[model samples]
Target: MTQKTFLVTGAAGFIGYHTSERLLARGDKVVGLDNLNSYYDVRLKESRLARLQQHENFRFIKCDLADKAGMEQVFRQHQFDVVINLAAQAGVRYSLTNPHAYTDSNVTGFLNVLEGVRHSGVPHLVFASTSSIYGANTKQPFSETQNVDHPLTLYAATKKANEVMAHSYAHLFDFAVTGLRFFTVYGPWGRPDMALFLFTKGILEGKPIDVFNHGDMVRDFTYVDDIVTGVVAAADNPPEGDKNWDGDEPNPATSYAKYRVFNIGNNKPVKLMEFIEAIEESVGKKAIKNLMPIQPGDVPSTCADVSALEKAVGFKPDTSVKVGVENFVRWYREYYRV
Candidate 1:
């Protein structure tokens, strides 16, 4: 493929940072955008941004997706080949105390991106969605074909809203828009609040780690690299309007428009205790466990049905939990000098 330009929102974020790196590595011009919010450590965001800055083809823009004027200005300035919206207020539990943040970033910010894409004539728009949208769902492996009408948390609700909002724009404006529902993504440079980061930090420092759901949870823990692979593949090939899509029995995953949603996750599900053990073995330390009940808006389990992704992208996220945990552990130790 020839050189292309991509506008990656939340460029300083974990998945966003990795996605920008992948695009730059392929000799693509990447205009990265981020608000540099203190949702987590601004220093961590800066560290990731600094590394991306080393690439000559990579340009950084510090702008929030919610800033309508700033976002409009960005679209006006750049002639992007593809626009990937990964910026959002991320966190399941944090949504409880900070509801406004979810609306401001996930809902309002996402709308701004849609408007920008609609007007800018960007051919393709790929944005991040989450498996948390599968709330009140007891299914073993969540499928994209299932109805996601009952989101348990504000964060999940906002993301579900994004999927709905994107579909409308795709139908009305006629452009390819893909939404990826990422399962428990974890790897190097992951968010601090994630289970792996917290468990690794607590184990290395001899502190008690809070194991929610009393260590009986299940997650299809996907490695970040695998997630990025699926993301790029989806971005590369934009889906077209499904001509045979039936209105009688509508498929939730695809629409009559050039829009779709896919689950990007390791098909293998690992128990919470097993995931913790992997981290412990990697760190060579045991965690002082404070097993607690499943918190509000927390699901007991999550497993992704990635068959749609495989058929569409010709790939599946097959990274092993052991290898992924070890990678994160090594990065944590080296980055923090633990």
Candidate 2:
């Protein structure tokens, strides 16, 4: 493999931090960008940045992706061989309460990323999408070929829109754009808003953990390291225009235009209660359960069909939930000195 410089947006984020660190470890130069928004905990973001700053080849830009001019400047200054965009206003329930945040980050910010890549002559652009796009679809083991037209929340809508936008750009500019639809990713240094973190915190504090959908929910609980693995593989293996693709029978997830989407998940959907049990085992404490109705904009379950990703990358995410939860709990205890 050739050594190259990568521009990774959302470097302070869970997946982004791990991706950047992995690249740095391999002797590649990384330019990381993050606004460090207080969506969850700024302290956690700062801690992620602190570790990346220790690497001599890593440089960080304190800016939001919505700042079009600033984004363009970053692109102009660095000739990034690959651009991985993970920055977005994330969270499903948060999208219901604060819809504008999703618009600002997922929509406007993503546009800025597209603009930067468009003008900067970046070869391959890999960005994050989510499984939430499979909204209201009761299908098991969701595939990339499925229609993702009906989105339940603004966040999912924006991500689906991004897929369309990326396809258009690829067709017009010959740019390679690959979108990875991630599942419920969790691990060490994970986001505080995610289920694993929330459960751990609640259990540790003797508080009741809300079991949504009356414990009927399931998730393809992917490990963060596993997420990073798929992301790096996608960036390295950019898709070429599908010459065999015909407009007569259009495929939503692939195009004749150098664009494609893949599901980066564990391909295993675990029940919510089972996930809670894993957390309990990790902490050696049982949770006070508060069974509740499913929140608006939340899906009952998500399972990924990762055959496309496996074929393209020659790897798959195989981390078991038990090992994953154990890793996370260890980190949480060390980080918080609990």
Query: In every candidate, how many clashes are there?
Result: 0, 0
Give lDDT per model, in order: 0.94, 0.92
Clashing pairs in 1: none
Model 2 earns a TM-score of: 0.99
For model 1, how big is the CA root-mean-square deviation?
Answer: 0.6
Q: For candidate 2, lDDT tens digit of each residue in 1-338?
A: 67899999999999999999999998899999999999988999999999999999999999988888888889888999999999999999898889888888888999989988999899999999999999988877899989898999999999998988888888888999999999999999999999999999999999998888999998999998889988998999999888788788888778888899999999989998999999999999999999999898888889998998999897578789999999999999999999
Q: Which numbered prediction scores highest in TM-score against the true structure?
A: 1
Pairs that collide in candidate 2 are none
Candidate 2 weakest lDDT stretch, 10 residues: 244-253
**Alpha-carbon error at 331 in model 2, in Å?**
0.2
RMSD of 2: 0.8
